[model samples]
Target: MPTELRPLGVTCNIQCHYCYQNAQREAGNMGGNYDISKMLQTVDQVGMEFTLFGGEPLLLPLEDLERIWAWGKERFGKNSVQTNGTLITKEHIDLFKKYNVTVGISIDGDGELNDVRWCGNLEKTRTATSKTMSNIELLCESGIYPGIIVTLHRFNASKSRLPRLLLWLECLDELELKSCRVHLLEVETPMQRQLLALTADENIQSLLELYRLERELHHLKFDIFQEMRALLLGLDNKTTCIWNACDPMTTRAVQGVEGDGTMSNCGRVNKDGVDFSKASEQGYERYIGLYYASQEKNGCNGCRFFLMCKGQCPGTAIDNDWRNRSEQCSIWMRLFEEIESDLITQGYNPLSQHAVRAILERYLVQEWTKGANPNLLRLFLHSSATSYEREVMHAYLVENNISHKWSQGKLAHLDHHWEGE
Candidate 1:
């Protein structure tokens, strides 16, 4: 659902005391006013292919991102952004290698473990995190491979600052920088949750030690434990957005757009910024009243991640109340019961397995109260599951031995999305 645009809305340069758009940039809502032909006609009437997000979308100008990446590389061939790599220059890495831009940045680990990214003090937050670790090592030595995020806090996941944030993620995996994303620090108050939060047992031990250094990394991949082992092996991994089923008033995994082009939700629930752009469709009526309210009323009753974490990410819900569930739901239920017991001790069957997770959690509580982001390998890939739910998911993948490999096509290239790490 990538469609960011946002000309300057929570406009930033540095002020990350755990910024979830800092109450819509302290209620004045930072910069604004746009029309570059209504932001390229809201990506040609939301036919979706956009990104250049912000609170710092390189604080716009470099000929306004060279006419927004030359009209997004002539209508979306290759272009994207999402920076905080403190105003990357050298002409913004030559307009991000001319347009094959993909870049993401937002660092939280490196010198001083990036001091809560607050640059109004502490020596301008270590000189803007040493110019964002030298523009993530010159945008990965100019080949331009960015995509790092790293938010977990307490000066970067403490326990002695998480072994220097895993030695700066092994120097961003020696700058080959495959992927990074970790973020659990969404704090925003009580002095950035007592100076940057991270204790649901230090957010499940810094995401189980970044999933045991992502099983001894070869080339840095932590889009949170490879998108939780690609959703417990159902794959189609859409690289983060809090394990799909987010809808803090219709977030639909980071949509934004505005500066004249309108359409917003997902300024991290705009806290109290007042329906930043409320286009209704009853965002799944609080995911059907928290799927039948019971966990002392914060519900997701008997949850085995209720069809891949639906009760999560309403911008860390709970007291922030996007109908409450994730105040980091006990560090994502202890990393989804430790990757569902390491994918059932490597034999697999973890679509949260109880006869295919009680028929996909009663058909995803009526397919997400009608908004639908449902797709567990498209329910055995055909008649969308109704030959008695594909005969109980092919008898629970033949009495649990499991790998039918999505009916032998070997997962025909699973492509779906959610967002974030």
Candidate 2:
């Protein structure tokens, strides 16, 4: 996971109505008054180049950014930052080029579609967006090629607004922007849900359409769908942390660094407040509890896809409650279904093949209680697992050797023997 350094914490220039950081800001977890020395010390101790992240990382002073970037360039070949794009200027672009910094911009859509990213009122919001658009254009003109991040909500990606969203993406494609990370709305409050969140049906249709759009576009790729297909292909490398059974407490998904050089959990899981040594510590409960949970009791049991989905991201958990499975559960399932069918039609041997699916599912749920996302491929290849772990976790062990279908029953019904039985 990439470590993120936040100089300004959750403080942003414009208030997006559905932003996850709002709760942190509300609880007075605002960032500022950071020490450059201490922040550098923390990163050096970790011994890696870090991504400058934020409420809006550009809110940091240019000299401060240059200082950090210079230090980063001296130590590591490259640096990175994920920003809202509104605050980026020509000087900032020059600094970015000097240090070889990779930039990522966050925008929902343009004009009326971006109303959810409210800057006090509609006119101000549009003006802010116009600045962001100009900055994006400037970055492209300067040969920056920043990756685009879009948060899908009713304001931007609803059934009615999707065409406009596509048109905007087409414009980005024309600009030669290649990579886009699309996030489903993280509905944190009742009001946001009602006003901005897409219905489950809407979310499903929007992404399916976007996937088709990706096929036709010369540039512009959605990271999520690509990651999903990668997971099915038994390729665990280079996928997002969400798919790998993220532990809510540890939240190793993204290593977040604070303004004062303290490490923090992923902001999505820190819904109530930004807790650290200053705040009380919470227990490691959610993901572990999921291990023994049964689908019959309204949880992720007997779901063959659990190995790949890992209950999705805990941040998107139902009601913003990490203990519960993701609220977008239905959407993930439908997308996985679509992708798996397509891969099968192409004669690709996806890990989710029915012949070995049940065994892997059964094995993964058992392994979950141990508090980790074990790689199914590693076990399949090396024959290095303990007796039981290697039993049916490998597809060949179950399909090539076993006499019965895993769906028929448990290990008792299809013990690891050749087809002779």
Candidate 3:
């Protein structure tokens, strides 16, 4: 849960057609309009890993940018920035080296493949991308290899187009670019009508192909594979945040600073022009109840991936209806199925009944209940788990001397009993 500082908020120079923040940015609502000194103080108070983000963070004044970099370097050993790479200059490259910043530049592909990332129009997009590639080359030549961030859409995610994109990535010889974060387009209300948005099926297709390509290219990494590989290898600690039951209300680890020095629930929480920080303050308690209620309502009863997926990203929950799982549910399910198959081939039983119980015990019983009182055993256990599976869980509990009383077809009064066991 890294802190993201959006100095300019949604006010970017280029308008990527599929951007979720377009509505806010189009309304001329730049976020960093708050008291800079207060914001800096807040940054110092919560000194940890900082991610400098923006409509475009580099669009901020060089002095302001330098202040942030200096603060991060002094407090934390390293920092990172996510930029479109259009505004980068030679001086900025030097500053990156000085602060040991990990630069993340957004680029879908070469020339025509990046048409959706527009700067006024197609011609401007071409020009901007050209300059972006040149800047990336310069970063690599200067021994600062920036990680590429590609937003997957119909424009660049086609089976035909992805190969070309991979080829180009490989051509960047001196670039020690290890990984790229592939963002499936965030299809919010405004982006629904955009032609660039990929359908759920298309999204699955693209990722399936990407996984195949990922296996071939050992040198270049994709973060999704990294997570999956970690999970498959039983190195769950290295898995991504997606695997964790990250309660947004409680954890709220993804903090965003509004332009007015107020804190937000992250950049995507509000897009209807309401100040998210203020809104969150007013309704945080209500939100906590709402989220928990949603989880109970949905009741991960039949979902085999409940432990690892935990209803997936709350940000993409259907219409922000936390009651439903993420809109990307189907895509993620398909990917997980593939990964599970691979893990089984390698002699790992990722989907074993024992594994499922472990997920429920750790994520649900421990994290949610804190071992004070046991709850949600009925909701956590998939209805599809065979009787043998139940026996396995019961036997394991008995062997470990964990006390529990079964009530109303649900396990209750669970406690670790060591005195009389």
Candidate 4:
């Protein structure tokens, strides 16, 4: 099913250094008025799952939220809100239950780790966080699962810091957290670059340490940590990693509605080439039409994982010099290889084989199903498919008469059938 993320362009109370929203912390007002009636009508027209995100969505008045929930329930069945958790109150919790809103809270970790950007008032954050914990408990008690979004920064990557974060989560009394998502801070703009810059060595070391701990916590009950562990252990290859940008299942069907109510293919690209204010003056549909018309001509044509990534976050692509592969791709590949080597050294033959098969199967499925465009497929196959087992794979394909082609750079197609399948 397609999912639509509607950015409310609202301001927030806290000033997080790494926030991508560019929200005004003091004014705490949305960029433009959010017309609930028009928004609901659009949701009904699209018939897609909707998510509310903002400078801080909770900053919106509770009555506005209630109206949203009522209209949303009549049109879209499920909805979610991503928030920083500082503004949650008992009334907010009740509204959540009334709307059946799935909650995702953004918190780095323990007081120390979380204090990195939650810097306005240490005592207030502590108080707010404690209250948020209670809210989470209330949600869980009410049978609503809540997820945590943790952003890893320079300090949180330290060997000592990671363990402490884990311990903190274990300590929370009401934290039956359903998931914990960890993401590296992406610094793209010059202003952002100045605000958040990490040395390459620091980044590498942090990733390595994170991967090590991830391996140690593989069987955790929560979803995020388990997924990270699986990724570290090489269990979450392209096939199993549902969030792999290449996987169609993980792709988000987003419509970017800007401050002035103009729509775009993706909100991430709202800052680029889109004149939302003008479009809003004209009509929302005009902007959407322009966006759809420009979609085919944009990025993802020559990408190796075009089928999988499908030009992820146009804003991210533009910000990162239009590179096809994301920064996380290299880290993931390195971690996978490291785990594979460790498995071999430990004499875990079956586990190592399974890891290898997972990687290969994903490659096979992508190439065979025409999931990846030919040029990208050729590069991946040529660079990685160079082993005795790979030769065996080619032989199997030939024997089975699979209607697939091999990369001409390294391996050539067999003229006749081979002995093995």
Candidate 5:
């Protein structure tokens, strides 16, 4: 199901160093407030499944959460919550069972890794992580399986750290935890400055190696990195990774409500001067309209990775490097190139598998012999089939000196013949 995330602007107990939300304080109450009833009405109108998130969503008074969950049950039939896990109590577990809410706990890795941010006293962070694990266990005992969202950073992406994490989780296998998800930290803000500034090649190598190891691990049932690797390598023949950010299908299509009730495009975009609470009251349509308008105005269409990126978090786009793709995209694309190069070396032709290599070869030979425009040649190659097919075709065309574009009439005729055949 397509998921929508609603941020409840409630304060979090722990102060993480790299928190994307400027959740530190309520400066003059500028963050604003959201009416839960209005928010629920909007969710109903959108007809999409919703997930509750927050500066720390669990900080929402349990009664408020219950009301939201009940309202959600009445409308969407299923709801979920993403929390830092410190606030989870037996009462929270009971409410989760009553509402059938799926829970996702945000814990980076082990004590050492988690303490990097979940930071206060090292011992306290470890204690909280252990308690959170217990909370996950309690929820599971109640038949509410919880997933862990681990943020990958310079510290946790180590080869040694990943194996340790997997082993630790395996040790906790009796708890019946749902699965663990990992996300690369994006270097888009001051909060991430330290992580971003650490440009050590060793760190990058460790992360890549860890990812490779994670893929080869047999005991783990769920590894997002594996899925990401497959998607990047074009291994998942049926699933196209060219997601439009504005499409409901895009995972990046998220709404973050801050503790102050102000809405931003996503967690990263919830920075200053991007309030949506007023328009949000007008409902989902208005909110989406604003988002799309901002996207277009920002010239995201011109991006090479536009189809895949969909202009991640306009607030981040505006505040930081507006033109930068998500850090995840960079990692994914790098892995994709590596896998594609490896496959090519191994005699696997992605185009041949897609059944377009022959057509592409013919086109490339003809175009090169005729001295066609490189741009036109590329446009034609792209038109012949899928993006991956187009990419392979372009590689062949470039190798043969075929132009990547076409003259208007010639391209039209060629396109007709290609489509007809």
Candidate 6:
């Protein structure tokens, strides 16, 4: 969990089309009158890792940035920030080490891939990307390796372009960049909706292939892949922040604070001066209840992945007109299939448990009808029914009213029910 502080609100130098906070900036809502002492007090009250965030947090005056960094380190013992990497300096790098600030730079990739994030003009964007990469190298030279955040878009998700993007990341890995967060482009604005070219299926397939390549190459690591792997190994609760006792309505796992010292839901919704936590209480709960119930009633009640996906990001779900699922549902489903198959290959049969089997029959099998892989089907069939398994299977069959008659010996005949797979 982190306390996300927006010191200057949405005032950034670069105009990234996909940025969700652009509306606030356009509305002249850049925060600058924040009372630092009170903000620090609120951050202390939260007692979590502090994150300095904004249109570009580094754009804040050097003294103010240093003061916030000092306070965060003194009170919370660690601090971090996400910046565009265009404004960083040698002095900032020094302060980063002094205050234990973990820097996360937002860059899509090298050249035109990154120039999509405009810097007022095409020529400026080209110049900025070069300087941004230079600053990244400087950070590495000073023994401070920064994490990269790549916001995936249609252009970057193409089969040819995706591998090239990976190669660029591999070069960064050589420069000692160790981590990256690969985010799917969220169509939050008209610009995003128009510019985003990749479909849900295309993005998922590209990302899944990227995961496999990363595994084979053993170079850089993606945060999403790590989380997925953690889920597969049953270490999800221990390793993943979002998976641990997260009641979305009440859980302030990531609290977004405004410049005027107001606490809000998160950065995306809060930049508009909305106190998201207070405003969304009833709305969030209602949406959650209705959405989950509908999913269960429709079939998800039987999905083992339900608990893991948890219907994806509630915000993203709402952004897509409260569709009862994440827009990235295709990506998540593919990821789970890969992870589950990997676990089986490693001799862990997730379906051996009656609980898993019961859930699988409800929706996992049916959902696979559209894109069932032959090899995965074999993995699903590999579980040998023990005496205990026989009892569980028989009970599941009767509870679901799956009419196939089953005795102790012909349990494997259940394959007939799963025809398309």
Residue 297's lDDT within candidate 4 is: 42
Question: Could you say which candidate leads in lDDT?
Answer: 2
**Pairs with steric clashes in candidate 6:** 154-198, 302-359
Which pairs of residues collide in candidate 3?
31-259, 32-259, 33-259, 34-259
In model 4, residue pairs whose N, Cα or C atoms come closer than 3 Å (at least 3 residues apart or on different chains), thus clashing, are 245-308, 246-308, 246-309
Writing each residue's lDDT as its tens digit, candidate 2 over 129-194 gives 988888889999999998999989998898889999999999999999989999999888888888
Write one digit per residue (lDDT tens) for candidate 1, span 320-396: 88786777877887888888898788676677765677776677677666667566666445434666777677666
Model 3 segments more than 4 A misplaced: 26-28, 172-174, 190-194, 231-235, 248-251, 278-300, 352-366, 369-421
lDDT of 3 by residue, 183-205 (tens): 77777764454677777888888
TM-score for each of the candidates: 0.32, 0.88, 0.79, 0.62, 0.65, 0.78
* Residue 337 displacement in candidate 6 (angstroms): 0.9
Task: For candidate 5, write residues 7-96 as lDDT tens digits.
Answer: 445346776666665432434223335577667666665567778876677777788889988877777677798888878998988888
Question: Which residue ranges in model 5 land beyond 4 Å of their true spot?
Answer: 1-7, 23-34, 158-163, 172-178, 189-191, 195-206, 215-223, 226-252, 257-263, 270-273, 276-319, 326-330, 341-348, 351-421
Off by over 4 Å in 4: 1-7, 23-30, 119-127, 172-174, 189-252, 258-261, 265-319, 339-421
Rank order (by lDDT, best first): 2, 1, 3, 6, 5, 4
- Cα deviation at 246, candidate 1, in Å, is 2.7
lDDT value, candidate 6, whole model: 0.65
Q: What lDDT score is found at residue 258 in candidate 3?
A: 53
Candidate 1 wrong stretches, greater than 4 Å? 1-14, 28-107, 110-112, 124-164, 168-181, 184-223, 233-241, 250-267, 275-282, 285-345, 349-362, 370-387, 397-421
**Cα deviation of 149, candidate 2, in Å:** 0.8
In every candidate, how many clashes are there? 6, 0, 4, 3, 17, 2
Q: Where is the poorest 10-residue window by lDDT in model 1?
A: 411-420
